[model samples]
Target: MSLAEAPFVGNASARRVHGFAAGSTALLVGDPADGSHLAEAVAELGLVPQSVSGGSAGDVLARLAREAAALATSGAAVPLTVFAADLRVSAVALLDLVDRPSARTSVAIAGPHEIAKDPSAFTLIRVERTQRLVHSVGSARHVVSAPNALAVGALLVAPEDVPAAAQLWAAAADDPWVDPALDPFDLALVALVRGGVSVSSVPLGPYDVRRGAGVTVGAAGSPWQQRLYGASRGDDGFFSTFAVRPLSRRLTAFGLAHGWSPNVVTVTSLGLGVLAALLTATESRAAWVAAAVLLLSALVVDCVDGEIARFSRRFSALGAWLDAVGDRVKEYALLAAVAWVSVRRGEPAWLLATTAMALTTMRHLEDGAYMDRTATSRSHLVPDRLDLGPARDLGPADAPTSLPGAVSRRASAVSWAKRVAHMPIAERYLVLALGLLTGSTQVVLWAITLTVAGALVWSQGGRTVKALLGSDGYERDARRVDGRWSDLDHETDLGPLARGAGRIAPLPFTASVVGVGMVAVCAWFIDTGRLPRVAVVLAVLAALVVGAGCRPSIEHRLGWQVPAALWGAESLLVLGVAATLPGGGQWCAYAYLAAVAWHRYDVLYRLRDTGSPSASWVTAVTLGVDGRWVLLAFLVATGASMQSALAWAAVLLTLVYGAESAAHWRAWLGREGALRSEVARREAEV
Candidate 1:
């Protein structure tokens, strides 16, 4: 393996580092007895630190500047981050300096002023890189030092700042007043301050400390890591306060000293979670408690992975996807166990468990769809949950926030039951724990099933009722309000679909799922032979969208516009026919399908992306008649023995997709939906 890609292990005396984007930028470690202190700190922040040892600061700067200049000439570039390497310093504080969005020539710690030679003198903090010096710091507080002050040692010199920074280094030698062999701070003093440069003082509170392991491990309140623990907690409940957060913090401490990476921690948690699933399946009383304990441990470990990533600056694309997929895997595995137990107990509770599983997948699908729409439109601080990319990949999206500090402490639930239910991981595990302990897994399933089904229905239903009652124009710009994400139509899009047949461009992932899913469902329908040959042939045609949709002959001529919609429509119609032929409460099937389809349509209308609000809204409402829900509904319809009735309902509902798809093609092809593109263009211009 390349040295850069080699796994890091805890070796107290070794210099640890992570390099990025290839050309070298030296790490100027200020202390050696400290054992690559700055280098390790830099590495923790996901950057490789280089050993920069020269006789003096001037010598070091001269060398690095020359190298940078050489690279510039060769069409390559290397930017440098210099650290003081002091044990008293916290690496967390250097993050802003590293990623500082400033256009400054050079940055250094707002050092103690020369005139403030005595302890009582003002620090003379000057910041030229940002407007914060003028915008935030009040006229009254400039000279006076605050109580929780940080000693700054980090400096960032962006590539644009290199030429001027290099000039300062060269000029320092000729200036007789400035020492030739200068220290880093002294160089900052002359090269920046004396040279009429601007410098800003970063918050010192969570960044600097008294040198000792105890300084970090001492009080739960002293170190940045401890502060991070508090910051990382979601607006959660008792389990989060008493169980998850506390345990996670302690594990954070353990991981830091041992130099554990986020992926390693995540894998460990997954293993424990899997073991818990196994034990829960055993259905023994003692095993139940242990399963709960293991399950809880897995959660804490799951949380720890994120904590360590934030702490050590090791956030990676893999960590993002792993964190998400790992939870889904663990949750579903436990649910599968619950289902198995339900089946063995001769309880229909297995159905509820499976329903929860299906709902979870659907929930993520919608969330993924939402993220895809906003992917490049805004820069996210915590990143979209589905964005499986490195932190650096984030670009200016007209919006951003750091994830750790995102949750509001004021966020709360009204009742205890609701609070527990709202606690996400804590609640999930607590419920699982209680169910296993009480040997009343069915009760938990009942609660979860009701909750999931109710939420899916109520939230969207309520929004629809509200929208109908207090109607808003589909052309309204949701981005005008901070509540854009929560707006019913934020995630759905009409785009080219309804605009003119802008083409039924399902995201690649969604398309794959739809296609493969149809093939599997069609295969089952054919093998059952319960279907007529005509119906079976229709099912094959539906599967053709997935099975042969990729073939050039089919894709080029038909594309996905017609055939894909036909597949969704035909499949639903066949199922609905089969379901309703026996006529047992087929109206329920109609209502259910309508509710789901209307939900998607409502969302798509607000986000039709067309210029004419009326056209966009009407077209989206007409074109977004979804039958995908029939896929899940059919499972229940068939299982419930209301076959013919629901089957006929499915056929009626099937027309939604066909009409919607045709409408989308006609609208988009007719250029009626072209307004959506114009809207984006206007937004870009803004």
Candidate 2:
């Protein structure tokens, strides 16, 4: 063996290893050292690694296999986790990775981009899970016909596979590369794959100490260092994804070393977040930009608070509860101020603003309540950042920070989910900043309204059905693995015609569209001058239908009772507001705007989910891709004077709309001898 491998190999016979204790999952620590940075991190998660040592990786495995079997339940595979003295990982993220469906020996490795600059890449070998092939962000570089190779760092092993691992480890140790030069991480990968183990990239961000430089527990000045410190698995927000995590982690890292607490960071974030709202709620142009910048800082600060909590081990149940409450308070203050600005502008978008806030609160509380009861502590709900005081305060001891992920946490057992449909938090704030910059209160209302409505429906609809009907809904909606095509996949070779036919059209949503449209059209012809009033009335009706359809149809599809009566009551309230308004005739257009706003947003969300076969490039020019822009274009055509909306309209129609209409209309009118275009294209998916 080479010099690097000598120490571990030489002491093989002298190392002591043990089997697991009763009711205890084995955490086997290898390669002990004086400073236990990683060992302490493992301890933070309440798993103190049973101290074990063996001469080689094989000896280590042999010991674990010999000892742990009797501790677990009969016929159950005992959990076995191996940690090196150097790796830093999120304990919760590690749990998710180990629990996820995988091979007998599942390994997680650092990505090429994640490690900064390490050339000793680990080849990734993932076993094909389905007949449908994938080629998106992760799969594009996949090596077809053979296991793809990429660098990785950690392994999550099932104890039963120890014999296989040991054999491979011995083979790797004998290789020329293993003695002096090979990375222990890469060796693990080699042994697993050579032993015929399938592999995938580490789902969580795990630190690999094999690299010459590592992120210190304390921050100094390296940009990459700061970003990594603040970052975690499953923060898929825009600013949080890119900006906030990086900047905030840098500050948090520094403060942590200098003796700062999570409570201090939380208080600072609360103050800054509230100040940002008050600033944006003003009429000054500069203040709008300032508000955006300050809001960005507040988010960054908000992020740091969590990092401090997690890193310092000072997290508390009460602190987590308060942090959530503060977030809602800040958002509410911001929304209330924005609503005030809208009324001042004489546009009356504050009506939509108030409606958005109420619904947003509902979505927030629902996610929080569900997560508190079921999952481990971590903010797992997308757009679930709002606060409601304790509904049922279950102690989820200071949730860990999750790395960037597909969605916050899994959204119930409901499958066929459009995972990337949630709005980016940074995009939401940027839109608000844009609206403020241009003094367009309507834009701000539109942004907030769609976000609130979509998230509320998406989070609550299925869960409510599950509670009402329990396991019956799951059985009814579950699809078997028969020979029928069922997904809205972009990577498959399915023809456009076949793809279109397979679209997931929820029948209840389709019915609601008809119900709302028929009602609107009949009201429109009642009086010539009252056309605008009719449009406004119709818009509110449509918003309710579209928003309702988001989750309502799922209930109907599964043969569950939908709260149609609740919807009927909401309709009455919509009419009551319309009739009671002092300036009903003047602000009526905004009502249509609100309805269409929710509908158009849902359309973009659904089209992407439905897997329309149109070229992605075509999506930019297509009206069905996003409806809010259509409303903006219409507002401009109707002489909206909010900061050159007319100019924007002129540009859209002259440069884009005519050609788009020709493209879409020609397809509808049988360019290929097909005539499927309906009279109204209001809810068209493609």
Candidate 3:
């Protein structure tokens, strides 16, 4: 029989069911006297509660196994969270810690005072510096004198681990180290450890627990709001932290008070950004000042959207995707506007503009590629994993007991310096604003290019070190360009010639550099009536770089970043060639490339999040990167009307990509149930 049809003997029922929007069930097994109150609180938090108080851990597990099996048929992945009656953990801490996307099977660590009050009632957990659990012990008395490990209580079993957890609980009774005095909470902790569960510990902080009362939620106080305001993303630059974010927090509060969704705020920001770009294109002093104001305002609102999402705890793939896309569109639109204003002033700002865009795109590509490639490796933040014997009190009183604590302390000291070196979006945008205020598009573009180039060198140097140092997940197979890679969509259009040429090199860095060199030479000679020859070289180079058939691989540590750089170089060449054309085709080129960049970014974000890029047909319609270069080379060489051709291409690309991207996101939102379920679940927890 199917799991849904299976019989369950457990005395489990939804004691208090909220809306189906918050349909997940929380299994409660704690002090029998506190069961009803706990159930009520949990229900109020939008979870269905099932109390199974006063049972051996094995007994509770047997029932859980049966019920969990039956519930599996429903297809909603609901975790089983076991709460300890005496643990006064707030919902904010619990959700933030346990509900993270990367979180594994986890247990809450009891505070020192709680462990001191009743040492026997908890399981001592010792972990390596990487926070990987190394040892755990529990009994009626102390397992080891003056244990150098944190005490573990409460357990959260992820959906996939529920069955294994049940089996482990049942087998715990047979273990020689099992203590008869252990309660369900302690027993479950021991069972999970002894069963070799890769458990992580969440240390309870002062804010996580109440002083005297039971569960004084931090979110209700002003201090919690302050904490949220200060919880900036690690990569946030100095200007963002000192100016944008502080202003954003007040706007975030206003947004929340007005019941505005994060997406609404994002749209508002996008509108402001578009307006700023339009004003910048006017090339007047008054317009420049207004544009700067609008751009800065847009940045502040951009921050507010994210802050609202974090503070309200309403998150979704759509919101994240929109925010990312909006940023790119705003930045690029403003960049093109800057170029337009410069050309009108009889200044040769095209080169500077293209250079700036290319550098910025390259930086973003590296950031995305390196981050995605090393995400798993960086999660632990350690070069080596230590698997030492049982932890003991071996050092002097002042010596540090936790290696992670020491690492964190050291890292905090250098974090500000590192952020300054990165020169993030806030700094880049500020530079543009400052240059505009000075009424010099050429100066601003040059400044942006130089700053970005320097930042890229710093950032890429660090990434190269990490990749070469044999970081976890930076192995050969992981770095290989495969179907998971979206940057080289042109490969599919190239056929076997491209494939063979790619295999000859197989290193993306080599291909990217060579392709870029070929394009640069083409751009240089295009104005000298060598367009046909340049187009031929471009075709051959494109074929070699985007070789199809074979699974081309980049053996180098920095291979994944090559595709992005190559793509940016291609865009630079396109813009450069258009600037030299007659009848002001540069604007048309910018519009075309902007549409093209949007599609590429769509492919990028989709691949990052969903493991699938845009459809192959879409690539064909847009002429892929290879096709676009060949066509542009042909048109310029044939003396065709460059303006009309570019304008049409821009219109066509915009319509196709815009429609397809919208359809895809709309479909994705529907499949995800518009994030209603997640919103409901997190609302109560936050």
Candidate 4:
């Protein structure tokens, strides 16, 4: 007889010959070939195999228990044999079954048989204890019911077991299931049953398989599987992604060595900024140099603080908060220094200082309020518990106490507007240079000191106010109520408004031509003693104001508002020089001519904000745009103007401004071309 048609008599005959019970159950465990033989022996002894298949270890154990339960409920005899592919399957299912006392237990070994010169052998063996309790007439019927009943009954089981049972039924009911279509779990289940072993427990732990004679079973740990698991953790080194430079590294190291926390660095920078302001108040040239150095040092230290935090992994919410407070202090100090200089020089000081303070404060307040509102709105929309503070703050030390504090911290941490105002290198240097040039060094130094004092007050004042009010009082104050400035307006853009003033931008071609012509005509007329000085001043101011108003959009985009204000200042300065002219029309004529040339140059070269331009470029352009022509005109008109070294200093500024402007133009053009090329490439690809 062929192996398939051979009587399944090996384990079955042993049980029968030994007078064991036909329904006794036994668990089968051995090599696949040996297990097949045991299965055939069990079948020969008149027992049946029940099988279940699944993908995961958890799923497999669940399926095995479900199949075992089904078999027991089907009225199978007390002794049943369970065949498992590996120890892992058997262990998992055995533990599960032990937990559920209702599951029936059995063991059997199904081993391969050789017949008709082929290895398509199957064996089933029954336990030798219970065969006499069975009747011969009903044995065939029990065997026939095994496959069909298990398949149909599995459908009535719990939803979780349905998928595994369905897989088993599919394989048994069709030949295609045994082909390449069969998964590893399905194949193992089918092979166990065919080897005459009754499957009870699912495969759980590692399985070892030998592919050739004298070959050892492969180890349990698979490299590919381990990698897949490890990759899920998602860790990447910092340098690979951030590309931090050596200078940043050195700065970070320095800060760490000095025991300087980011917050401390931020505070120290503010202090230095105050020193720069004080320098501006001095008439001495040495004071200006000192102020410049201090400001530059502050900028460097400011950069180092952040780098240190990132490098040392010591970032904190409090540090960030202090940093922001320090930034405001520095800004106010610089501006105040300028005002002090103006005041000492007999200019209107209080008005300028107050205006600067109010504008800066309001802008920051608006920015903070807007961010808080936006975050609150988003939180309401998304149902997630988002902690928007520093990564460290989310831990036990700062577990959120109240909804408002949590929201406030998050809002403060992520407000982009606050960061934008102070971080750029160009901005810090600009403030430094402006402070040095506009006022005496002592004025600058005093401004810096005052700024630091103000910052300390603002920062500490809020907490003091909150403490006096108590928690309930603070909460009441924190409550939001509708007010003005909440509404968005089209004119909210800051850049273009600043640039519309000629002081922040290059003069338009028409303006340049007209300015040149008017200066020439005024100079010639003054030489003849026929020019009107007041008319010249009024006419020039009117032209500048009108010109500035015409290109509001461009000014807004470029952040030229300050430059525009400076233009108004220039006109006033020119008027002052003209009024002081000794020869009346003759000498005053030079002042008018100089004003036109200087204004034109200012419009063309004054540093305009190009949305985060490089520090080098900003500095270069700023220094290049000189007002020497205007100063020369002032000297010629006043007649009594000093020829001291200090007078020559003004002339030097003109040359610097010119050089900076030329360099900036070159860089801007290159950047523009690169951007255009990138756009073209993207379009082509599309």
TM-score on alpha carbons, each prediction: 0.46, 0.43, 0.75, 0.28
Q: Give the TM-score of candidate 4.
A: 0.28
| Every candidate's lDDT | 0.45, 0.42, 0.61, 0.35
The TM-score ranking, best first, is 3, 1, 2, 4
Query: TM-score for model 1?
Result: 0.46
Candidate 1 stretches greater than 4 Å from native: 1-76, 80-92, 95-205, 208-238, 256-261, 371-423, 453-686
Candidate 4, position 397, lDDT? 45
**Model 3 error, position 162 (Å):** 1.7
Per-residue C-alpha lDDT of model 3 across residues 580-647, encoded as one tens digit per residue: 66534467766776777677677777776666667666765766665676677777778787778878
lDDT by residue (1-686, candidate 2, tens digit) is 11122212112111111122112243443554445544544443334466545465444544544444333334454445555444544343343334332225555544333544432333333322221111111111212122222333345556566555555555545544333332344335444544454433444344333422332122232322322342443545544556657677667756655666666777888898788788877867788778767766776777776676554333343345446555655665676667667667675654566566545543443343343223211212111111111221122335222222333345422332332234444445555656666656677778777865775566567566665566421322233232332221211212222223224432344544443453334233322324444444454444444333433213233222122212222323332333334332323323332332232222222233332323443333423211332233234235454234323433453344335424543553352232112211211311
lDDT of 3 at 105: 71
TM-score: model 3 vs. ground truth: 0.75
Q: Which ten residues in a row have the lowest lDDT in candidate 2?
A: 131-140
Ranking under lDDT, best-scoring first?
A: 3, 1, 2, 4
lDDT of 1 at 358: 46
Q: Which whole-number lDDT from 0 to 100 does residue 263 have in model 4?
A: 71
In model 2, the runs with Cα more than 4 Å from the true position are 1-61, 70-80, 83-107, 112-208, 211-243, 254-271, 279-293, 309-332, 342-347, 352-423, 434-576, 583-686
- Supply candidate 1's per-residue lDDT for 422: 33
